[model samples]
Target: MFHYNATNLPLQGAPGSLGRPAKGAAKKPPPRRRRVTLYGLTFSLPLLAWQLLFFLAPLAFLVALSFWTVRNFQMRPDFDLVNWATVYSNPVFWQTYLRTLVLAVGAAALTSLLAFPCAYAIAFKLSEGARRWATFLMVIPFFTSYLVRVYSWQIFLSDHGIINALLGRVGLGPVPMLNNTFGTMVGYLTLAFPLVVLLQLFSLVFVDRRLIEAAHNMGARRLRTILEVVVPSARVGLVIAALFCFILTFGDFVSPLYLGGGNPPTLSIMITDTTKAGQQWPRAAVIALTMIATLLAAAFGAVGYAYKGRAR
Candidate 1:
């Protein structure tokens, strides 16, 4: 029997069969707002241990050591500003800093120049199969150790080496390609160029070929097509390549050390020897901090370049 009026159905659980749902029905509650937290002593303890041991502990020590003084090659834990003062006062420090900056800029410029042409060829001129092989050849050097590859320049440019010997065969005197600033710039270019090309290749794939065709149809010649059509399409790629070139070249320490040697004295070598007496911690920290600051500035410059490239 039913007792409900026409106006409405029975209320929930009011009684009898009319008000009640069937047995074994399932109900869902509202969704919950989740919070992310690292859980478990077993799971998180190792990560926490590593953060303290490898990261925070060394960083704290380095910061403290930068405030310390060195006497007779002995590191005193007593805080002092002598290392900072000494580093700032040295004329050699500024010279090395400026010289290295120039070399890095040269490297970055050369890398961009080479990468742009190579990238354009790979992206536009090559067939699909050829492009793959070309890309592989460009980047394969990176798989080898940078030291070994850069050292190979010595072998090629050495008096007894391949380039000179080839010149000897040609009855022309050997051109000097190794030693001094020119040689160091070559090393920087060789090391950084392939990476720039690789980065640009990714951007190149996004370029629309139709845009070039449209430009050509509108009386644009080959040079004009590149400047007006292809370049505009690939601007982002070029900026990306330039950014990589700058960062890699500026941050590089090894190329100048081995190739340039202490005669020219790049920033890297100067920072190391000058910062250490007995306690190497403080001056080294300052050098490290300076390098970090320069790197960050380069990063900001890259972002600006990318934005400008996009706008173009």
Candidate 2:
């Protein structure tokens, strides 16, 4: 009988002698990882370039323009405090800013109010197929051009428009719904409602139905279950919708221009009229900067709230 020790087996085929790797040696990393990273960069480069070209570059130019002066309405590259001083000291700017803020906030609130029940029905009550159809119907309005839709609202709310004409059939006089803040709010709500519904519906759909059932099993009431469980879980979506509406409405020039009737213009309209119509680029840039800062602050606050909710 031959006594063969395992340690002496290397004599037959030593590690690395028969083209096998050493047992304890580190293997070379495959080049495929680097290729994957290169591929990712290649895919994302277009988006990065677009952001740099259209967004960041223009934002930088606008910031620089804010600090520059406009001599006799000709934009100059020289630094000056005159524009900032003018914006800060002007009562009209502040009033317009406040009005725009109020309108934006009001519209966002109303949109949220209207969206919640619709979203709840879609998320909890409707079958999946019905929900899909409902969502499609909600989104149908967006297929039309935004300007045309807003203009349609202008016609709808006009003195002799459909709404007023309907009221007239009921022996009611024409209501003043066009060319004012109320009309502006109606327009904002119409545009923003679908977005709010979609966001809230997404939030509601993903909520663990089990949690609500669990709460109810513990004798929690329907409203209490919703207020305590559903609302907290959907806070992120709510915050996002509110912030999006605020940012969009705050910066909206077109709706205000078309609907506001120049009685009490929004800050966005003021910025446009100042820059393009009045040729006050520096002042317009200042207003732009202010609007940007305000939205950024709101966004940061929303992020903080969301983060805190997550942490809790």
TM-score of each: 0.79, 0.85
Which number leads on TM-score?
2
Model 2 CA RMSD to the hidden true structure, in angstroms:
9.5
**N/CA/C clash count, model 2:** 0
User: Per-prediction RMSD in angstroms?
Assistant: 10.1, 9.5
* Candidate 2 local lDDT, residue 32: 25
lDDT on C-alpha atoms for all candidate structures: 0.73, 0.80
Task: Give the per-residue lDDT digits (tens) of candidate 1, residues 77-184.
Answer: 877888778777988777777877777777777888777778888988899999999888977887778888888888887777898899999898677666667677
Query: In model 2, what is the error at residue 251, expressed in angstroms?
Result: 1.3
Residues 168-277 of candidate 2: C-alpha lDDT, one tens digit per residue? 99999798987888778777876777888888888889899999999999999998998999988888887788777777777887677776675688888887788678
Give lDDT for model 1. 0.73
**Weakest 10 consecutive residues, lDDT, candidate 1?**
28-37
Candidate 2 regions exceeding 4 Å error are 1-41
* lDDT computed for candidate 2: 0.80
